[model samples]
Target: MKKQVCIIGGGPAGLLLGHLLTQEGVDCVVLERRTGDYVLGRIRAGVLEQVTVDLMKRLGLDERMKAEGLPHDGFNLADGERLIRIDIKELTGKEVMVYGQTELTRDLMEASAGRGLEVIYGAEDVELHDIDGANPHVTFTKDGSPRRVNCRFIAGCDGFHGPSRQAIPASVGKDFERVYPFGWLGILADVPPCNHELIYANHERGFALASMRSNTRSRYYIDVPLTEKIEDWSDERIWDELAIRLGPEAAAHITRGPSIEKSIAPLRSYVYAPMRHGSLLLCGDSAHIVPPTGAKGLNLAASDVYYAAEALSAFFGKNDADGIAAYSDKALARVWKSERFSWSLTRLMHRFPEDGDFERAMQVAELDYIASSRAAQTSIAENYVGLPV
Candidate 1:
């Protein structure tokens, strides 16, 4: 096979980039190591920043999202006693769309054929060759036969564990990471959310989040030790913990139900420098990972795709290489800002095992300041709603 670009990982990032490139008349193919069903089965963050929503809108894929997705003007930050609502709309003149990442991926995947974007699923042992050279190619097994795609560029949207990032020689790449001591034990249930808007609560016990996919499907999480087992947590036990951690008002509105899905996800903030290396451009998790404290994972991926598509489109459509040359610095500038926001939010909301009484006091003081000051609230609101692309 031959193409202008070979996109590794048929996840949202790769698929979105493929569609965008196709719109610009750039020939590209997407390869996935897993089946489409497996990709959609993975639960992920729901909040959509404007950059993500705009990309979907640009691709004419926002019909179902605009119809079914919830738009929130604000979210709450609780400090055990009261809710500190940050009015994102009022502060930043923007709002976030609460639509599950699965739904968005489904939209992109379903539209691939109609948009002339070819996606190959269940590709095995995908490997990249000659990435540092002007010409790069990818090889993998499809069914029992080996297949190779010769392309001008390759997109490493395969995520954190995928082969794309690993293909970059250690001498050419550097990693910065912080693994949180805790993980989020989350539950998805068929019940209305405890509140109309999302809430990040800091309680005496730990950290908890109250959010939803829709009016009928609620998603909630509580921080747990990295050693905690999902099997040990029952539906009722999780609900009870949420009640105590979210405070009295939210608990009164809580509705309990069987979990449609339950899991424990470890938190980490990771970033790989120089998202672009020769003919390879790393997008999404392959390049960076946020702690999920501010729901930046998928949105960050969208932004990366936005830049990658532009760079590739310029290279192919206009014979311009400036976008490709500047892609890493432009994307990383935004990536680091987002990383800082996610890290700050995670530190503010979660209780660390190593934290002392002074740390707790500092948290209280910060929360109190945020509650009383509009400037503080505005700062949080702007970051939560997302900064500019």
Candidate 2:
């Protein structure tokens, strides 16, 4: 019936925040509208920056990740047959870990098991009440009965469509969004990746990405028109498109198989400015979204949770309201930088519908510079490994 912090949504963002707060002896409750199985089944990005990994380590959730997760020092950028490698470790002195979001969530869930952390699943019509007031509370129905939890603060970690963001008065926050004309048609197969590291390609036909989940599981994607349907793409067609977009050199290492899963994800860059509204603090997809091109979707969420948890910790530990008060401004600062990186990378690789000679030439020139200039490469590498969060 009461908690220090009531978290909406049991996705990684909500769960991670709750876990971190609990480590600080903060009392929190996580509510999810879906079953745990449903939560764990959602597949998401696998790349993580050091900041995310460090957070997991701090919460004692990185044992499995450190053991099972793959590490990559750099990734490839391709312009047709030409391969441009950006060595993140060489340029930034850091490396990214390739652990899937699902795996990380599972690790977090397991760590909290039997720790007296209350995570209620299948909560229906979850709603926030009195968020603007000093004593904010959350209400939801479980098993056809209404339940409520009063808290000092409420965290709207539920994703973009959840009710938490809508709880804020429309006049209080501004929304910025950019919907791309295309989507990533992706497939998961039990095949080794074409390369040891990820490969991003800009082809005459479209954009392509060669990535992996593990040594035996490969994830690949190619940009397609928004009108394209997953049903229209067969396993063979997907591989063929990848081959063409990846060029002869990269395609030479192709390994093909029946897809275990396939889908098309629309790309969008969205941010709800001022992540905090009174006692209701927004985190992760509930506050911001970035295109998958930069592999920033999950990492950005991690950073959001990182800032939110730190702010909450400061608030409870030292009775410091400044961290909580400035959370919105501080978080938004990093959010915009990441948005710029994701937007720039998306523009550099994808073929826009209105792209003419100059647009294409600009993309080529930028990619060339990144490949040849150490400064250009370092700029990207630092952003990729993540800036100081």
lDDT of 1 by residue, 198-238 (tens): 99999999999999999999999999999999999999999
Relative to the unseen true structure, what is the Cα RMSD of model 1?
A: 0.6
Pairs that clash in candidate 1: none
Per-model TM against the reference: 0.99, 0.99
Per-model C-alpha RMSD: 0.6, 0.8
Alpha-carbon runs more than 4 Å astray in model 1: none
| Candidate number of the best lDDT | 1
User: Which pairs clash inside model 2?
Assistant: none
lDDT of 2 by residue, 170-270 (tens): 99999999999999999999999999999999999999999999999999999999999899999999999999999888899999999989999999999
Query: In order, what lDDT does every prediction score?
Result: 0.95, 0.92
Q: Distance from true position, residue 74, model 2, in Å?
A: 0.3
TM-score of 2: 0.99
